[model samples]
Target: MTDYNAPLRDMRFVLHDVFQGPALWARLPALAERVDADTADAILEEAAKITGQLIAPLSRNGDEQGVRFEAGQISTPDGFRESWHTYREGGWVGLGGNPDYDGMGMPKMLGVLFEEMMYAADSSFSLYSALSAGSCLAIDAHASEALKAAYLPKLYSGQWAGTMCLTEPHAGTDLGLIRTRAEPQADGSYQISGSKIFITGGEQDLTENIVHLVLAKLPDAPAGAKGISLFLVPKFLPEADGSLGARNGAHCGSIEHKMGIKASATCVMNFDAATGFLVGEPNKGLAAMFTMMNYERLSIGIQGIGCAEASYQNAARYANERLQSRAASGAQAQQRIADPIIAHGDVRRMLLTMRSLTEGGRAFATYVGQQLDLARYAEDAGEREHAQRLVALLTPVAKAFFTDNGLESCVLGQQVFGGHGYIREWGQEQLVRDVRIAQIYEGTNGIQALDLLGRKVVADGGQGLAAFAAEIRAFAVDAPVHREALLEALVRLENTTRWLLAGVASDANLISATAVEYLHLFGLTAYAYMWARMAAVAQAKLAEDAEFCGAKLACAAFFFERILPRGLALEASVRAGSSSLYGMEAGQF
Candidate 1:
């Protein structure tokens, strides 16, 4: 097993250079008072320590112990409960929540960094925090003032945990098919009846209660996705005095036995005429669920980035320590048996690839996080609207591409270890298995691609793309020499977006069949742009420390020379279209 190390310098580079943290915080009233550079840096350092020191050591043990279910009760792995207590006591779960609700009210950008670090250390442990933050976001957005006042405090305090219950046995992404029903009673509460599957943190012993934000249909509601409504169903029904009362009607039937993330509880939940209160207007549930879903999408992207970073660190460390064949030029001066594996060009290739992707993903996530903050807190309406559209446009890409990179990066990391990577004790194999879910869950990467191409770009008549392109072009115009790669990457993205838009009206299938490849191309181009921007900024800061700047420049060069060409392959695949994919008849086989 490898010890986790927080990439502090890299995080600082991205926070200060890539995103301009101070200026952004100065613009938002909610975060303006406490989010200067020093405070942000301190927060990141503290979060990194907690994740690396407290959470990382428990990862392997958590996996080994898994979550235990006995006699209708659930218990997390050893050390997890202790870590959860530490996390809550440190005010982490509420890092981005409303201040009035016992939250620290940090900006989403900062919270995301903390989140990625946690995921990097132990994703299974991170789930409890991630789900709570997500639930708070949704409730803050859609729930009544009373509900937010009542639930957000406890959730933020980590006295209680939260779960989003949208997936049922018959539906996951297609919520239109969900059969969960909510019937109104005389006292303003509703009776919720249905089963929710794949609910992370649905039922757990880590908290006093589990608050469920469920989606169900009202009897008088319209049909399909339009008819669904959001509800707040807490495990322990609250007293009028705001204290815990009797237990609610919902319970966890069982926890999933999965291929990975065994320590993170995924439950099958049964809401047996559960007492529930509507969070939003009737039949407006899908819109509200999206509040949580979109947040999770970005978090899922971070999951990918985190696991990739973890895998890369392990692989790089192992390569440096393990002696193998001599360098290509043959042993210059014999030290021991041959030389370290890091001496090989191919090994360097894998390490550089991982570094480039992981760093790029982190930068991208921060960029999106900044947009989210601006959308909520910027003074200008136009800026806020633009930020909102950009957030929507980029969320799916971040979620899909980053996770795709995550899976590939982990696989490559495993590949570097050869047979040892596949073995259990080495831990590399576990990462390969665990990171796989980020691609599948939180809306499949395929679904995310379809959303980006179909809804965000084509359906909007290129408005969102135009807004993003205009900003990138503005940045490219002012950027320095090495930023030329960023300019090229943006140009490629613009051309690809234009091509997809042009073909969409004639063939809507352009995105349906080609969306996944388009997503990959888009991700590579965006990441390239991000890497170039980071390198250029780091270079300017080099007088402060040349070694750190040199590393940034090296990673940027590696991305351009080795990784950016992947855009071409993905673009070619996207242009290949559905002719071959859907052409074969059912009888062909």
Candidate 2:
């Protein structure tokens, strides 16, 4: 396997050229004084060094060594504890965190790119940090000032780690069915008693303390999702002076033996009358938890993109080096025994597919991160609202489509290695196993599709989607070469939206059956828009940098020609409706 590189050039192209992150940051007062093009570049450079030199080396070891759980204590891989400290010392844990609590307060646009690099370096190792960031977001957003002051700093500094305890043995996606209970006490704190499974970083030896943002039903709570409340439960209670105190009632029951990401501890956390403090209003926990949920959903999406990128880098390097057969045109390397596998058309196809998707995904993820930054930091109220709407509309799409495409890209990357790809030593198969969880967890891709179609599009009357399409249409007008393809994709997306909205109301099964395809259709159109935007920027810069800019244009062309056509099949499937899907009765298979 090739050594993992940060792909800083492509990252910069997307950040500085395609998204114009510097200009965007300049407009936002929160980011203007803090981050500029130079600062962002420096941050990226440092991030590249850390990920490449420090973290990437631990990936294989993390997988092979995994983790060990004994006597309610979990141990990470050999180097993880030291690596976690190094990462935290770099101030990466607070990259996008609030500045009020000693965070570096970088923009999400930059954060996403950093996240991709770290994830690509080592997915299992990355999870420990990612979970902390997500937990910090929830605390910063919904937790009381006291809670924030107490937890945010420690969490941000990596002195203490954080976990989102939402799932139970019985509850997965349908959180309303959770059995955990949180009872109020006289001192405004609550006693949280519940068993949360699949808790990433729930119990680990990496940090001094673990803060759990738990969801449980209140004693006087109503029912279903509305009845749930969020609690800030710490593994070790904090003193008034912000130091670790006695251990709380939470412990690791056991850690699961997982399919992949084995180094990241997936623990069964049992909280028995754990001392806890409420985050937001009572019975509003789900809403509060969603702050973390949304943040994590996007982070999980990046997980997919990251793994795919790692897979592509290794696969491309392999394709260029591995000698297999003569080039279809003739022997290009007569000095060698046989031409490299990259000489073959099919290998090039796989490599290009991986490249186009991975690069386009990078741009797409950055775009969403830009929207998130605007939503939070934009000066104007209207701009904030518009950005928020777009964030809500596309968050699910980003989470689902990026991951779904990420898995497919990883598999394609594996295929480029042929039989060797299936073996574990190559690391290709590990990427497939690691990225597979992104789709299944953080609200399954199917749930994301329903959110995209049933709620974001149909329920909102397509206003958010229409706004997105208008942006694409505007870009198409300026894109001379790719205008037709961009416009055609916009039309397909718009038409598909209309069709789904029209039929969804009449047929209850319609959205469920067709939501996935509609999401794929929307995702394709969005990526096509990204390609057009990148292509326009590349075309303008081709005179100055022929190699880099030309490569961008070539990838955009591949996207429009090869990948974008998948939207046609998605559109057709979406238009076919739910009739054929619901024909079979229960247990018919």
Please identify model 1 stretches exceeding 4 Å from their true place. Answer: none
Q: For each candidate in the order shown, give its overall lDDT on alpha carbons.
A: 0.88, 0.91
Best by TM-score: 2
| lDDT of prediction 1 | 0.88
Worst 10 residues of 1 by lDDT: 478-487
The most accurate candidate by lDDT is 2
Q: In model 2, what is the error at residue 533, expressed in angstroms?
A: 0.4
Candidate 2, residues 305-366, lDDT tens digits: the string is 99999999999889889999799899999999999999999988888888888888899999
Our model 1 lands, by Cα RMSD against the true structure, at: 1.3
- Relative to the true structure, candidate 1 reaches a TM of 0.98
**Alpha-carbon shift of residue 546 in model 1 (angstroms):** 1.2
